[model samples]
Target: MAPLKQRLSMKIAFITPCNAIAGGLFVVYRHAHYLQSIGHDVRIIFADGSQGRQVTWYPNFSVPVSLLVEEAAAPTEYDAVIATWWETYYDMFHLNARTYLYFCQSDERRFYEKGLDSPALLVERTYCDPRVRVITEAKWIQRMFQNDFGVEAGYAPNGVDLSRFHPEVAPLAPRGPRVRVLVEGPGGVPFKRVDLAFRVTARVPDIEVWFVSGDGVCESHWQAARVFKKVKFEDMTPSYASCDIIVKLSTVEGVFGPPLEMFACGGTAVVSNVSGYDEYIVDGQNALVVAMDDEEGAVDALSRLVSDAGLRQRLSAAALQTARAWDWDQQTPIFAKVLAGFCERPIPMPRTARLDYLLLNRLRRLESAVSQLDPVHMALVRSRSREISASE
Candidate 1:
């Protein structure tokens, strides 16, 4: 690979599952935007066909986007086609590209029950594909790929957009006598463990619990004092600044961003010892780190932050320092260099992988058609399929 200063502009395509307001997808879009700014011909391919639809959540997200159909039929070829999610991996083989890449944001297999779902197995299989070069957002994920799958994955840590989430941003709500504790993450996602954050915070007295969800849905049982649903990305700083502390408990993560964003907004955090928190979170130093699924421990940590004003102030100050070190301008160039290196060595997709994708695509389309015809029968079939998968 040549030096960064000597690298020329190369055409790149990032295949995304959808244009949803997801943290992972936002990272992908940010990468595309960064590459475009540096003179690379970059475009985002929406596998779900949500092309030309504006992502209203992200401010000034002006990266070019196209549907998978358009890319598959286009005359110009991409220097590298990267898969941003597991489902989009299958679509990579269909596009015209010199080299293929898989940007594993998380251990996606952990999203499902082990040995009880075919999707988990399929996700695992993508890691084993020899054609696609793997890159990840977390160091632990890079290590997991090497130790478990014997694949050398590149690592590029996610960064906080300091310009948007900074201490200078005014709080959305006025500070009062009661402490405001923020709980972030989608409500319904099981791995996110948002319910646990709400449950633990509820045990602490005299602290207002605020919930912010990228997905618009918040369950009635969560009982949050205030809910900010689907907030614009650039507009999230005020929400974070309004709260004193944020409690984010997740079972799986890829260098999660909300806590760091909270840190950038001059707020402390209470997070679980999930895989990626170790990247920056220091227990009792910058943020309170509790064990996963330990409800009592989380409650204790939240209470400590709420009652001990000195501790909150000390931790928030330290957190701001940590956030300062993780700027987007510093981290995004690492990924661009990875892409430049990948384009230097092109690998042809194997015939077997191409055939496998064709067969799997046909089966999935048939399954989708059947589910549309009889929803009840398909539900029963999925239940039985889970049973068989478990047995296998």
Candidate 2:
């Protein structure tokens, strides 16, 4: 008889809050996709706070504690649970698995002046679980978490989706004047510092600002300026495709998503010197790095890119090269190692024929249950989640 083949040994689950919106959940999505590519049975557990079927919206709001207990009674028998954010960390704590928390930012700073007790401390004490605090860039913030908060941290800087954002590609339609700049929003939560965009636009009237607004922002902000509201997430690349430059100056950020996305698009990126900006963006190379004090720096960088097409061409080329290096294919392996390390099993188990059938049927049922809700109700729930988070 032939020797029995070695069986693969573990299941890994990622727990996210509600939905994959504009922040850490996006990172979770990228990790899940990449982890799947590498032969891990990585499934996302969307606890009550999120829209479960919509993998796009992650880590929503927590379900009632009693409901969560009943829902997760069996706990899916995973080899490990990786919690991507604080709310998910709480969920993972209650689950029956070796748990790890991927803390993205300083909880103190994240909840500063917001009046909630320190979530990191609460989770640490209540769960008493092993955690691997992860940070984007911002060495200063990292130090605070370690030295001040007394938590050891790890660094796995976030990356961009390179295929969706490449400089050689052009927008399908005519983007007027070819002087496009990417700005996130002029309204919505004040955290993004949309006012800064308005001020910068006024300062640099020569350059056209392209605004990308999320669901709740008012249309008037766009009417007063060049704006693109409700752009499909997949089609957002076109905004980058048409742009000559990308400018985002936010008050707070984990990894500064737009600048990285723009850099991947091969456009010159003029980003504020904020938390996590310095991790990859180098001054005078790949992209232009500006100081927060000097909003005029945005104009100067744009003016330079506009006048020197050759320089623009070179930066664009370098930017794409840099972006390609940071693609999911490259970064995911490191992410996988960190995830796999948290679990007891050395190798991920292959899905059995029965397991595949069960997953398919289960996902179908979840989809049906979620599909019952109307689009407007779904939006309302999501908006409510944002308000709760903001208040917290």
Candidate 3:
């Protein structure tokens, strides 16, 4: 592709974690993609090389990914090498890049335990590091890093692929007089609160509820709803299209993506009244926000949205407007300007880093091999095995 603008083109690399269908890594990938599209030299290298999982191109994304194959892969000479995760902060730290940046997708401290290997302090150190320019996806995260840690940070929110996930492509189907309700990440992973969804579902027996998750997040609660496992990224249009009300319960997040995807595909989002969603989800306007612990309120909100067609259509229209604002076409130039400020650095990669890269590459291969099993089916197998063991 020819360079769009006649200026400020530079080499850039994103030190991303795992080649999974994850949100944070995708944001980094999409950023790299946008920079490349605008005629900049861009590459996405896996952090530790160990997480260079098997699949480079998943249906969820369309970016060409690469690994730190050689010690020379990450030469300090690159214009900028942005780190996508906390662990990779150390990777970017050791690299001899001219300009170093950290992509903060969320407040990672939420993932750590008090005394575990993932200590909050370790994650906090990356945020507080003076050498790295911190750019966060959420304003709350930017404020947290600056206010609590006394660090400088900038905010850059995520955008949806409007062309790919729009209402026309995934048309809403006739629900045959029954309100089709959709709940994401069922009952496991404490934050998703699928269990609470089950409670709400029980209250609204008249409506039809469907659950979706790649992992066994809804294993125990599978019987509570019509569950679909490992729904491929491309295949989710129908899921979003058919549902009248989508209730996504998250204890914490960084502007959750699925709700936006649903919104883009003509579905109304009934989300938790938490930091991640409150920024964009204006209650009664675009989305219905339920209090974190208010299961009854969640039920009532779902009932109100499903039963009222005008309310659902109006909210979805406003939601589409919100989604349109965050489209990559609009945000790409803004992101380019932010990185342009730091690409002046030029350095050389150390030969010693090769050893670490090779080891991680080997481990990543092993992880890739093991992770090939369908996560949900594997969870089922493990559950059955345990039951057999107990019976024996």
Candidate 4:
């Protein structure tokens, strides 16, 4: 690779859903910041037309911003336009760019039921589209795309922001006898499985459970001693430092960051062996890893961490060592290189066939809806509605 100073600067645009406080959006902003730091012209284009909106949740995220509303006049040309989410892929059609890329953060198709949700097919189409270049944050996602979808993708692991999440922040609060356990992710999202985390943590005796939700929702059934909602990105370090262990039982992820963040805050984690945990988590080494949906195993692991002080000390020590190695400065350059390489290649022609798939999916949904209705009752209702309209 050439030196940063010697390389030609490329104009890059990242298409995002909104300037929301999400883990995925944070990653996008981090890459944009790094690329801009290296003398490249970078901007984030919000598809929802949130013009002049800055990401206030994340500290010091000062990348350039633009609006990319559909049917409006297209923005100026760029060397590369990267879609950060599935819905943003359609927005790429209206943009002027030399190269289009999809930043696959996760197998988003798994977020919804296949048959019931119509958008699953649309999300799947973005991965299979041949024209769009693909880059992912997890090796597992790269392999899954290769084996499952036959689309090879570049890989870059997400890095922790060490300045905010580190061991030297502050001392733990004065909880003399009770062990404080933290559970992250929104409770309303099914894939996060916050309910399972609550259930397993409740089995342990005399432990204080804290729930931190991005969506500010806490289910009534959850026995949370304290709930922190929509915490700013910079303000989360104290929460992690105060807890001894974080229980993350997410069913799907593309290199999840909370476990890594917790590790940086001088704490251990009990995580499910989800898709991305193997990237950093070592079972019984740095953090305890249980099988997915293994309620009993998760309960036992949390209980062991609460009761065994020596074990907790060993895991937290090893976890801190792991976190120190994955700084943002080190990881963002790999993603920057991937983007630069794509910009150097020949621009492939846009695939118009995706529009055909979109139309067909909409028709299929309409057909399914019509098939569920009674034809004779529908005819009468339509005739009566027409008569009412004619009278008016």
Among the numbered candidates, top lDDT falls to 1
lDDT of 2 by residue, 1-392 (tens): 22111225446666666543555666766666665655556666766643444443333322212224343777456566666655555455455554444545433244434333333333333222224334333456556567755665555556776666676567744456656667774367665666666666556656666677765475454423456665555768877777777777766666666777777876777677766777677777878777774667866776787667788778877777777777766665566565444443233322342233233334333434554677665455444433433332
Candidate 1 whole-model C-alpha lDDT, 0 to 1: 0.84
Off by over 4 Å in 3: 1-4, 48-64, 68-76, 115-118, 171-174, 186-188, 224-226, 344-392
Task: Give the alpha carbon lDDT tens digit for every residue of 166-272 in model 4.
Answer: 98887446535788999999778888999999999989998998889988989888998888899888888888988889999999888889999999998899999
lDDT of each: 0.84, 0.58, 0.69, 0.82
For model 4, the stretches where C-alpha displacement exceeds 4 angstroms are: 50-52, 70-72, 171-175, 351-392
Per-residue C-alpha lDDT of model 1 across residues 52-166, encoded as one tens digit per residue: 5567777788888888877778787778899988878877778767888999999888887777435787678778755688889998999988999888788888899988889
**lDDT tens readout by residue for model 3, 1-392:** 23346766777778776565565655677777778877887766765456454554334444455665442454446677788877676665445566778888878787766762234645665675455677777888888888887866766678887877887774435555777888776344777677777778768757888877745466564444467765656667777777767888777677788888888877788888777686577898899998887988888888888778899889989988887777867776667766665444323334443334334334334434555667775455445433432332
Put the candidates in lDDT order, highest first: 1, 4, 3, 2
Sorted on TM-score, best first, the list reads 1, 4, 3, 2
User: Which pairs of residues collide in candidate 3?
Assistant: 50-360, 76-96, 76-347, 76-349, 77-347, 98-345, 98-346, 187-194, 187-195
TM-score of 3: 0.79
lDDT of 3 at 315: 96
Provide the lDDT at 104 for model 3.
84
